[model samples]
Target: MIRIALKMLVGDRPKYIGMILGVMFSSFVITQQSSIFTGIMTRTFGFINDSPLPDVWVMDPKVQYIDDIKPLQDTQLLRVRGVDGVEWATPLYKGLLKARLSNGVFQNCNVIGLDDASLVGGPGNMIKGKLEDLRRADGVIVDIVGAQGRLAKILPDGSRQTLDIGDTLELNDRRAIVVGIASISRTFQSQPVIYTTYSRAMNFAPRERKLLSFVLVKAKPGVAISDLARNIQSQTGLKAVTAEEFKHMTVMYFLKYTGIPINFGIGVLLGFLVGTAIVGQIFHNFTLDNLRYFGALKAMGASNGTLLRMIIVQAIVVGLIGYGIGVGAASMFYHVSKKSELAFRMPAELLIVSATAVTVICVIAAIFSIRKVFKLEPAIVFKS
Candidate 1:
C-alpha cells in the first residue's frame, strides 16, 4: 500500500515539481530575508560587541541605544569607578565628527576614543601598526573598510587611492595622522571609524562640557554583574547595563522605532501565501486525479487512517526536498554576498525557524489533499 502511494506521488512529474518549487521558493525567501534582517540588527550594537573586554556599559539615563550617545560629565567616570565590585573603569568617547579627507573631501565618521592609559576598547584586529600607535602625537587608527573605501583619497582619474599609514585627516581643524589600520565590524551607519585617545577625541569633538560618552567597567572577581549594574545605577543616578542587556536595548529600540521588522516581515508573509496557494491547490488536484485509486483501496478494506498516513508520508518527502534545496541556495547566497557588504548571518536557530516554516507550508498543503481523500466514496472506484 505504501509503495503504491509513493508511486502515485512521483508519477506526475509536472505536479510534483510544481509542489517542490512552491515550497522551495517559500523557504528561500523566508530564510534569506530573515537572515539579512538579523545581520542588520546585530550590527546595531556592533561596537559594544567589539569591545568584549567591558563587562558593563555605563551611560546617561536617557541613552536609548548604542548610537544614542548622551554625553556624561567628566566627573561621571570617577563616580562609576567609586562603585563597589568595580575592578577598573574606563571612559569611552564615541561620537560622529566630520573628517576632511586627504583629498579635501569632507565625510562624516564615527570617532571612538579609548582610555589613554589602558587603551581599552581599541580594535582587536590591527592590520598595519600596533594598537599603542595611538599614543603618538596626533595619532589615530582607521578601520580598514574606511581606509580602502570612504576615507580613501579620490584620484583625478576617478579611482580611489587607499589611505595608508601616516595619512592625515583634519577633524574639527585638528590634524590627525593615521598611525594604524585596524579591521573592525561594520557600523550601523556604514560610516568610517576612527580611533584616538580620550583627550584627542575630546579635542576633535565640538567643544562641550560633557565629554564622556560611556563608562566601560570590568567587574571584580566573583562579583555578580547584575548586582554591580544595579549598584552603579543607584550610586551614580545613571543607567548601567551589562553588555548583553545593552545589546538587547539597542535591538529593541530599533525594532520598536524602525521599519526593519515590518519590511522583512512582508517578504516572509508573501512567501507563505505563495506557497499555500500553489502547493495547496496542486496537491489537492493531484489527490483528486488519484481518487479512483484511493477508492479502490477503501473498497479493499483499507482504513481511512492508512490512507491519511499515505498523504502525510508524501507531504513529508516533498517538504524535506524543497526545504533542503531552499536553505542550500540561501547559504550560497550568503557566501557570495559576504564580499559585497550584504549583511547576512545564518545562525543555528535561523535554520530551525526555516524548518518550522517549511513544515507549516507542507502541512497546509497536505490538509487540502487530506480533506479530499477523506470525503471520497468507494463507489467512485466503479464509476467511469
Candidate 2:
C-alpha cells in the first residue's frame, strides 16, 4: 500500500513539487525571521556574556536595560565588596560619547570604562593591540566592526591616517589615542564600543555624573548568588540581580517597554499563519484532484484508513523536504549577513525551536488535508 501511494504521489510530481516549494519558502521565511529577531534580543547583553567575575550585578534602582543610563557613587563598589558572600566587586562605567574621526567627522560611540588594572568588563577579542592599552591617560580601544567603512578610513598623513596600535584619538571631547582595535559581538544598543580607563571615563563623561553606574560582584565559589544579591540590595539600597535575572530584565525592558519585539512578533505570527494556510490549501487541492482515484481504490476494497495513511505519508515527505530547503536557505543568509554591520545571528537553541515549529505546522496542515480524503464517497467513482 505504501509503495502504491508513493507511485501515485510521484506520478503527479509536478503539482506536488509546486506545493512543496510553497511550503519550503514559507518555512524559510518564518524560521529565518524568528531566529534573527530572537538573536538580536539575546545580543542586548552581549556585554555581560564573557564576564569572568562573580554571579551578581548591582545596578541603580532605575536602570532597566543595558542602554539604560544611571549612576552610582564610586564608594558603592566597597559597599558591595563588603557583603558577606562577595569575593570581589568591580565598577563598570558605560555611556555614549562622540569621537573625532581622522577625517574630522565625529562618530557617536558607546564608551566602556573598565578598571585600568584588572581590565574587567572589557572586550574578549583584541585583534590588533592588548587590553592594557587603556592604561595611559589618552589610551582607548575602538571596535573593529565599529570602525569599518566610513569610520574605518584612515587620514592621509601618516600620523592622522593610521589606526595603528599606539595611534591616539579624541573621545568625549578629551584628547585620546587609539591604543587597540578590538572586536566584540555586535549588540543592539552599542555597535561601536570604545574602551577607556575608569578615571578617563569619569573625567571625559558629563559632569552630572555622581555614581559608578553599576557594580559587578563576584561571589565566593561556594556562596549562593541569590543570597548575595538579597544581602547587597538590603545593605546598599540598590537592586541586586543574578546574571540570568539581569538578562531577563534587559530582554523584558526591550520587549515590553520598546515596540521592537511586539512588532517583530506580529510579523512572525503573520508569516506562520500565511505559510500554513497557503501550503495547507495547496496540499488539500492536490488531494481533491486525486479524489476519483481514491474513490476507485475504495470501491476495490481499500479502506478509508488506508487512504488517510497515504495522505499522511505524502505530507511528511513534503514537510521534511521543505524543512531541509528552508533551513539551508536561512543558514546561508545568516552567514552572509554576519560579517556586515547588520545585526543577525542564529544560535543552536533557536534553530531547534524554529525547526520544530515548522515541522508542527506541516504536520497539522497534512492532518487537515487528510480529513478531506476521509470524506470522499466510494460511490463517486461509480457515478462517472
Candidate 3:
C-alpha cells in the first residue's frame, strides 16, 4: 500500500517539483532573514562580549547603550570600587574620532580605552602582535576586520594589503600606531575599532572635562552578580547591571527604536503565505487527479485511515527534502560571507523554528489533500 502511494506521488513529476520549490523558497527566506537579523542584534553588545573579565558594568544613569556614552566623573570609579561585594573595578573610555589614514583618507573610528593597570576590557583575541605592545608609546590595537578593510590599500590584482603592526594614523591631531591586530566581534556601526590605554585614548580623543566613560567591575568570589550590581548602583548612585542584562538592554533599545525587526518579520510572513498557497494548491490538484485511484482502492477494501496516512507520509517526504536543501544553502551563504562585513549567524534556536515552520506548512498541505480523499465514494471508481 505504501509503495503504491509513493508511486502515485512521484508519478506527477512537474507538480512534485513545483511543490518542492515552493517549500524550498519559503524555508530559505525565513531562515536566512532571521539569521541575519539575529546577527545584527547580537552586535549591539560586541564591546561587552569582547570584555570577558567584567561581571558588571557601571555607567551614567543616562547611558542607554554602548554607543550612547555619557561620561562619568573620575571619582565614580573609586565609588564603584568601594561598594560591598565588589572585587575590583577599572575605567573604560569609549568615543568616536576621525582617523586620518596614511593615504589621506579620513574615516570615522571607534576608540576604546582599557584600564592602564589591568588592561581590562581590551580585545580578547589577537591576530598579530602582542597585547603588551600597547604599553609602548603612541600604541594602539586595531580590529582585524577594520585593518583588512577600511585601513588597507587595494592592490592592482583586486586584492587588499591590510595595515600592518607598524602602520600609523592620526587621531584628533595625535599620531597613533597600530601595534597589534585584535580579533573581536564586529560592531553594530561597522566602524574601524582602535584600542589603547585609558590615558592614551584620552589624549587621542578631543579633551573633555570628564573623560571616564564607564566602569568595568568584577564581583568577588561567590558573590552574586545581580546583588553586587544593585549594591554598586546604590552606593555610587550610578546605573549598574550585569553583563547579560546590559546586552539585553542594548538589543531592546535598538529593536524599539528601529524598523529592522518589523521589516524582517514582514519578509518571513510573506514567504510563509506564498509557500502555503503554492504548495497547498498544487497538492490539492494532485490529489484531485488521483481521486479515481483512491476510489478504486476503497472499492478493493482499503480503509480511509490508510489513505490518510499515505498522504501524510508523502507530505513529510517532500517537506524534509525541501527543508534540507534550503537550510544547506543558507549555511553555505554564511560560510562564504564570513570574511566580509555581512553578518549571518545560525543559532540552534533559529534552526528549530525554521524546521517547525516547514513542518506546519507540510501538515497544512497534507490536510487539504486529506479532505478530498475522505469525501470520495467507492462507486466513483466504477463510473469514471
- Winning model by lDDT: 1
lDDT at 381, model 3: 80
Question: In model 2, which runs have C-alpha deviations exceeding 4 angstroms?
Answer: 153-162
The number of the candidate with the highest TM-score is: 1
lDDT string for model 1 (1-384, tens) is 777777888898999999888888988888999999999999898898899998989999999999998899999999999999999999999999999987788999999999999999999999999999999999999999999999998888989999889889999999999999999987688999999999999999999999899999999999999999999999999999999999999999999999999999999889878987888888888888888888999999888899999999889888999899889999999988898888888898988998999899889988888888799889988888
Regarding TM-score, does 2 or 3 come out ahead? 3
Residue-level lDDT tens digits of model 2 in 1-384:
888777777778876787678667766787788777878887887777755464898988888987786888888888888889888888888888787775677878888888766778888889988888678658888888665543465646534233556655677667877888887877886447888888788876878647487788888888888998999999999999998888889889888888887777777677678768877887777778888888899899999888888887887788778878887888888878776655666777766766776677777777776777778788889786
List model 3 lDDT by residue over 1-384, tens digit each.
888787888888999898888888888888998899999898889888999899999999988887889998888988898888988999999998899987677999999999988899988899999888999999999998889889786556867789889989899889998899999998798898999999999898886788899999999999999999999888878999999999999999999998989998998898788988888889889899888888988899899999998898889878988888888888988888887778788999998988898889999999989988999988998793
Worst lDDT run of 10 residues, candidate 1, spans 1-10
Clashes of each: 0, 10, 0
- Model 1 misplacement above 4 A: none
lDDT of each: 0.92, 0.78, 0.89
Q: lDDT ranking from best to worst? A: 1, 3, 2
| Candidate 1 pairs with clashing backbones | none
lDDT pick, better of 2 and 3: 3
The candidate, 1 or 2, that scores higher on TM-score is 1
Residue 170, model 2, lDDT: 70
